[model samples]
Target: MASFDVESLFTNVPLHETTELIVNNLNISHLDKFGLDKVHFRKLLGITAHHSVFCFDDCLYTQTDGVAMGPPLGPSYANAFLCHHEQDWLEQCPLEFKPLHYRRYIDDTFLLFKHPSHVNLFLDYLNSKHPSIKFSCEMQKDNQLPFLDTMVTNNNGIFHTTKERLAWEPRLTIGSMREPTPFHEARLVSGANSFGRHCQWVTGLQVLRSQSLRCSHLDFVRNTGKRTIIERHRATRC
Candidate 1:
């Protein structure tokens, strides 16, 4: 039995591919002198060097005859140095508020504050505590600063988003919610139905053409008795 009902009519014809025309070419040129790749540049930019405070003589004295002893206190020494610096910074904080959260990994540090005043306090603390380390707040806007992959703001706010490619732009939303509509569902169903109808129409046309050609060839062979004519001529000559 045939699957399609030829009596049914399809209203809309679906387009398989769409073409777009652009008026201008919008390619930008590189402006940096170093010509280093993005990964290398990021590594160079993010680097922070922390020198070990332990002297060579002290390290040597801590080591034993066969094996180095004294509980492998490298991390302890670094932590102690950082703590001393942090304490000094806290003493001079102007806002009369300290960070609610503090995280540090090697030379990288993160400080979280509750308000704009706290951010100012933290900045002053940082300047006084670690004078050798430089601070750049050029990217900050409206009391918002970027720390690692998050945007930290003055109102005790933190915003996080997925990491994207270099050429991508972020789309931000504050507080918005949307409900699904019947129109969207109908549009999807209509698209699928149109696509299926066009596919079936094309397939039917191809099969019909092929069958017509095959029938025409069979009729031509029946009408022309070339093989029989040749056989009769040979028999007559014999």
Candidate 2:
């Protein structure tokens, strides 16, 4: 059996003093300029926050836009603005927006690339551009990637899962300020279940598998909003 060293996986690599110095000298200034607090920002931007509630004019929306009409407006607008405000952000973002090649539902982001280098480059770029956004990546060889309950394999021979890529929970301790959670995860999972039930309700089991299969063909899908058991399973599978 393949062994997983959970402790090793979770080992805390101490930040070098020099690295801290650089961050203090260079990155800290930028972070401060943006009015960002690292600890708070990380909590707010963690995987769980991806599905936090976002109230916009009383119209509910999931970060993934699974139930959205046309394109989900909030994240789309936010990302576009970020891209424009920070040109470097776009250069580093793993998702391709040219033809709208990527999809995001809160913390979960799905992207397609022709080469592994593209993925690495994009990840590196993201790290350089937005040092605030914590990311972890895994590669699947000769298999479909998971996305929510669906699995997506692109025409370019790349695959992605429609599921949350990371597991996160908020740690609220005394003396630590709380961070705002993104509602994408909770919303997407709920929306997917609702949509799935709606499909099953109206279409019945005869067409359920086909509908699910078709949905899985999407290039990107997000499942963070609802935080359901099935969504967790999908993420684990991915």
Candidate 3:
């Protein structure tokens, strides 16, 4: 398995690609949903992307490329832009470079492959996809790698997600219980010291709330000496 992190995601997002992705996803029939014409929205986004300016070294400079990192639409636009390239790469890249398993949390991505050598090939493909959007990779050592909120382990061909050695807070609470959220809650708490103070109020998949069990109920019991319980509403792990 390998983990990939996009280097300088927002600042290097490529404004042209960002505008295209947004226009493509912003459907015309959903005019009521978006409350604007597609062409008009495109124009607005173009201005927003192109008109971004910043002061550095006591000089004002116009940003010629990439969406600025400060706008409310920055995350959504950049996400759409990156996801488009990833989707295209899935179809165009070599089959050997394809990942056996893939999961992305905003800018950080985790991929599992059948052969270790395929990782280098895949990273090459990813970096070549866009000059501005490059990827850095990490291969698992000793069969485990930290990803998002859990430690993913590859046992034979079966992949398992667990939080056995993940870091957590001592004073987090959920209802009547006191527990902590681990790593990225879809990047909501990616670099946060405190979940609430460092980031905005947001929620994610049940995994964000409780990463308390493994893929196997039997394993949960064998390790923790406790009966397995449901998370949110699902009996299955997310």
Candidate 4:
């Protein structure tokens, strides 16, 4: 198994190139009739400066390639753009090197390769596909590795998971803030149930095989998200 990160994915995506790629890949004649052809799209992007025009510290500039990281549209556009390449890779992967499982969220990707010998070769091939988008890979130590908020372990062909404390979560304290609704606050503790459900769904592992927290630690675990969760909810409401 190998873990790969797309280095500077959002900032590295070439805007004009990605748009052109999307247009060509779509190959929809109706898009041309609707004036959504590559030429028109490029012209529209010029108006938005490929949606990369911005001012920082009172200076104006334009990004030559890549969309702005902060825009809501950037992620969706970037993911769609990468999908083309991902599909090609899947189609072209050698049978012996084909991954047993693959998963991705935004730029983070986890791949379960069938053979260890093919792992580095696969990573090299992926990185060589595009000069701007490069993948950095890690081979798992032991049978366990961390991805997002879950600790994944492969026991032979079976997969299991354990709860992990994401770095983004704050440490627990007695004075954690509360949500206005009981149901909202309860998810901090109960969210583990969701996590368990997600692990089961993703890996088809029995829920009983998952990591279990000590009863005494529930308060600490649940309370960790209290302040941040409330703050996020309040922000969204405002």
Residue-level lDDT for 186 in candidate 1:
25
The residue pairs that clash in candidate 3, if any, are none
lDDT by residue for model 2 over 136-174, one digit each (tens)? 555544455554334455545443335333465333221
| Global lDDT scores for all candidate models | 0.33, 0.35, 0.62, 0.58
Q: Which ten residues in a row have the lowest lDDT in candidate 2?
A: 1-10
What TM value does model 1 have?
0.28
Model 3: residue 120 alpha-carbon error in angstroms: 0.5
Per-prediction TM-score to the true structure, in the order listed: 0.28, 0.29, 0.63, 0.61
| C-alpha RMSD in Å of predicted model 2 compared with the true structure | 21.3
For candidate 3, what is the TM-score?
0.63
lDDT of 4 at 70: 64
Q: Count clashing residue pairs per candidate.
A: 0, 29, 0, 0
Q: Which 10 consecutive residues of model 3 have the lowest summed lDDT?
A: 172-181
**TM-score: the better of candidates 1 and 2:** 2
lDDT of 1 by residue, 1-238 (tens): 0000111111110111000000011111121333433343223212211111112421211111111122222222233334444555555555566766555432345555565456655554565543334333223466555443345555535444333344555343222212211112222122222333444433432332353644533444466633442233223421
